[model samples]
Target chain A: MFEGYTLAELGSIFAMQGFAGLILFSVFVLMALGLAIIFGQMGVINMAHGEFMILGAYITYFTSNFFLNYLPALFSVYFFVAMILAFVGAGALGMLVEWGMIRHLYRRPLDTLLATWGLSLMLQQFYRSVFGAREVGVELPQWLIGSLPVTDVIEVPINGLFVMALTLLITVAVAVLMYRSRWGKQVRAVMQNRVMAGAVGIDTEKVDRYTFGIGCGIAGVAGSAFTMVGSTGPTSGQLYIVDTFLVVVFGGAQSLLGTIASAFVISQAQSTMEFFLSGSMAKVLTLLAVVGILMLRPQGLFVLKVRR
Target chain B: MRSGNIFLKRNEVVFVVILSALLLVVFPMALDSFRLNLVGKYLTYAFVALGLVLCWGNAGILSLGQGIFFGLGGYGMAMFLKLEASSPEHTAIQSTPGIPDFMDWNQITELPAFWLPFHSLTLTIVAILVVPAVFAWIIGVAMFKRRVGGVYFAIITQAIAAILTILIVGQQGYTGGINGITDLRTLKGWDIRTDFAKEVLYFVNVALLLGCLLLAQFVRRSKYGRILVAIRDKEDRVRFSGYDVSNFKIFIFCFASVLAAIGGAMFTLQVGFMSPSFVGIVPSIEMVIYCAVGGRLSLFGAVYGTLFVNYAKTIFSESFPELWLFAMGALFIGVVMAFPNGLAGLWQAYAQPWFDRIGQRGAPRPISPAPISPTAAPAERRT
Candidate 1:
């Protein structure tokens, strides 16, 4: 495949596609973080997780439109406001779903998958009806658009770089919140042993709800960042849901670090193969490899040293 | 336990008879050929639903990838039909006169080795059943042997479905692409497109469905069925009691896949085309909803469930396309939340009591092991 290209050209090609994979990695990590927390901790398969992300995407859309229409001078910084609103909007909805449907089906993990699938269908239809079926692309701020040329052959898109930086910031914040914060300890305590956490005077149920909200909130931020590179549609979320789930499952569902690592591995492999093969074939091979590995190591890439 | 273990007690026989009458006599007499063909297609899904009744409802193995097997069988039949339709005489104008048109378009001058066996009717029939069975066996062995069950199994199977769909859609030349294996003209020189052939195919579909229903009944009523239920309820206990839990799980999953495959094959014969649309994640999950709506426990209810949901889908999606998603979404939520046991559960609760009170007081209780609620987790609960 590389026979035609000079060594320098091949190097640049790898670098460019490798960067593309990093952007995909950021998306996967952002999408799977919430899912890993909800699925691993609660053992509830939230099939509507993608829908929740789409909710964030839609919020970002309206925020951008508002800024474009009413605040022309402030358009450059509108994404910051959109990110906050998307987080709050998606988080609030996640909490409501947790309180309503998911709260009822915790015991049956399988049933949760079905119910949330129902939830996903309703949400998708709602989006389709509210927003026309056509995919809507966000108009990027001038500062966020364009590309930086590292060399004559290798150019990197500014929006991709921005999304990557944003992913790094959020991932670090999530890591710190999960590991170093007092509340994070409480959440972990509850996940580790509900009865013990309750016995210790921790409000376990409240912790559970908040943990779910935070997970979903992260997904919303992911979607906010996604507006930079991809167009949003009612069903775009469905396109990534399977891939996101694979990242979470293959990474070791409960391990945040595992999720990131797996996402990086999968995204990189997919992008590299996609350069050589047709996009669909590349995706099939990537997923097939993941599934094959998962069957062999059902516990996933990282198994937390928990007694259970 | 033995006394309660019989297959289709007296009144249950009457139930099956009436159901058969509806499919065999009443539907044919009333509906036109086109509508009857549509019904026949829906009945194919009933094969899948009945398999779910045994595997999912009875044994507690929820596979989200039934569509893989369904597609495998569908493509198997489709391959044969495409070959027969693309004979040298019919395709004399093309560069590759004998091979499928898709292959010719893809610039392949020769037929692939894999498509050769599809030329024989016997081989096609064998492939229809064995292809899915073999694939299911592989998945079943790999997952079950490792004690992978529940949500993990479902997700893995779902991934397989996605991979297969992508493969089919991507490798257009080999598998007929997104349009799928189309322009299917005949089956063993009989014009399947004709109305008379359509009626004949519908009867064959119904007969195969009933045969599958009986096979499922046999599995449900035998000792293996009891073991399967035990494994579902108390898997560890069953393992401790010296039964091979994985073997039972594998068997049921493979059995379900085979049933789904047979449905897929019949669907190709009746519908005259096989497409990737039917074998993807969306359609696969939709198939599960069919089983869910029919009361996952009752075989007879499964058939009705498949027909009712598809019929509503056709009508609503055709008339008010937008409302169909909402309606379908509501159906999934409603089936899971309000009636986990489905239509059969409703019948067992309200209608059956009235029947029992009116006349069945002196008769033996007519019930299957499934319709009655089991000591399992209720579908919904609040902490």
Candidate 2:
């Protein structure tokens, strides 16, 4: 496939595709990060994770509209406000769903998947009703609007860079929150031994709710970041759900670092393949590889060295 | 489960008789050919749902990729119908005269090697069965042999469905692309589009479904079915008892795949086309939900679940399109959370006892076991 390209063209191709891959990597990382928490840690499959992300997208969409209409002066910084609002909105909804739906099905993880799927359908219909069925995009602030010319043929979009940077910061924050913070410790403790954690003075129920909330909150942020790259639609989130689940599961579901690593590998492979083959073919191949690898290594790329 | 007199205990025989009558006579007599054809279309899904009862409800193996087999069988049948429809006289305008129109539209002058075997009707039918069985066998062996049960197996199967859909849609020239093998006109000179033909086809679909129901009932009643329930509830216990657990899982999964394949093939015949839309994660999971709604444990319930849910879907999407998802989503959550046993469970708990009371005066009713969470020690196993 590369045989037709000149040396300079090949360099530019790899560089450009690699950059594109990096943006994809960021999206996968963010989506898989939230999924790893709820699904991997809690043992609850939230099939509606994608819809929760779309909720964040809608929140971002509405925030942009509010800032545009009512606070034009602050519109340049609206994304920051929108990100926070997306977090709160998505997190609150997450907590409510966890309380109303997920909590009952904790003993049945597969049932949680089905129920959340139902929630996802309702959310999608709600989005369709509220936002209209068409995909919508947010107006980028001036600072995030353009691209940086790296070379004559290799240019990187500034919004792509911004999303990647945001992903990095959030990834670090999540790592710190998961590994370094007290709440993270409590969440981990509960995940390891729910009864023991409760016995040790952890509010396991509250932890479960918060953990689910925060995980969904991150998906909101992912959706917010997504508005920069692609238009948001009622069905947009669903397109990524299977891929994101694959990323989390193939990463060895319980490990955050594994999620990151799996996302990077998949995104890079997919993007590079996109340049060589058609986009759908690339997706098929990448997913086939992931499924194939999973068959061989069902625990995935990483394991926590723990017994169930 | 009782170890003797396994064809059907008294109640099951009554259930089968009632179901067969409804499927064979009641539905046909109640509606026009068009509605009957639609019911036939829905019955195809019942095939998938019935298989789900054994695999997911009975054996605790939840496959989210039943669509793959369904689509494979549909596509295989569609391919043969397509070739027959795309005769040299019919497709004379295309660059390629003898091939299906989609291939010609994509500028392929010759048939793909893989699609050649499908030109034969006998081969296509065999492919419809064998292909999915082989595919399911491989997948079931890989995942179950590795002890990858639960959500992991579900996700992997879903990924396979996604991959297959992408492949089907991407390679449009070969697999008819996303629009699918459309404009299927006949089945080897038999005009399938006519109302009389449709009525005949409806009976064929019902016959196959009843046959499948009987087979599923036999399995459910057998000692093998007992082992499946045992595996579902206490997999480790069954493993320690020296039965090859993976083999059982693989066999059952293959059986489910074959059933789904038949459904898919029937679906194509009834609906006139098959597309990648039915071969994705969404449709696959929706099929599971159909079984879940029907009473995942009840084969009789599986048919009604497919009929009523699809009937609702057809009606709702026609009237209030937006509310359909809400209804569907609620069904999923409600089924899993509130009524895991579905309509069958409801029938057993409330309706059956009431009917029995009406049937006999002052007779002591058989006490039905209350519903228990699948995780809890089984207060009532279905037998």
Instruction: TM-score chain B for all models.
Output: 0.94, 0.94
Model 2 stretches with alpha carbons more than 4 Å out: B1-5, B359-383
DockQ of 2: 0.68
lDDT tens digits, residues B1-383, model 2? 46564566667777788988998889888998889999999999999998999999989888999999999999999999999998899989988799998898898999889988987999999999999999999998889999999999999999999999999999998998889888888998998889998899899999999999999888876789889989988998899999999999999999999999999999888889999999998899999999988888889888999988999999999999889999999889898888888888887778876876666655477545432322222233421
What TM-score does each of the candidates earn? 0.96, 0.97
Best by DockQ: 2
Range of the 10 consecutive residues with the lowest summed lDDT in candidate 1 chain B: B374-383
Put down candidate 2 lDDT per residue, A259-302, tens digits, no spaces: 99999999999999999999999998899999999999999999
TM-score of chain A, all candidates: 0.98, 0.99
Q: Which ten residues in a row have the lowest lDDT in candidate 2 chain B?
A: B374-383
Model 1: per-residue Cα lDDT over A203-282, one tens digit each: 97788788888888888888898888899999988998889888999999889989999999999999988998899999
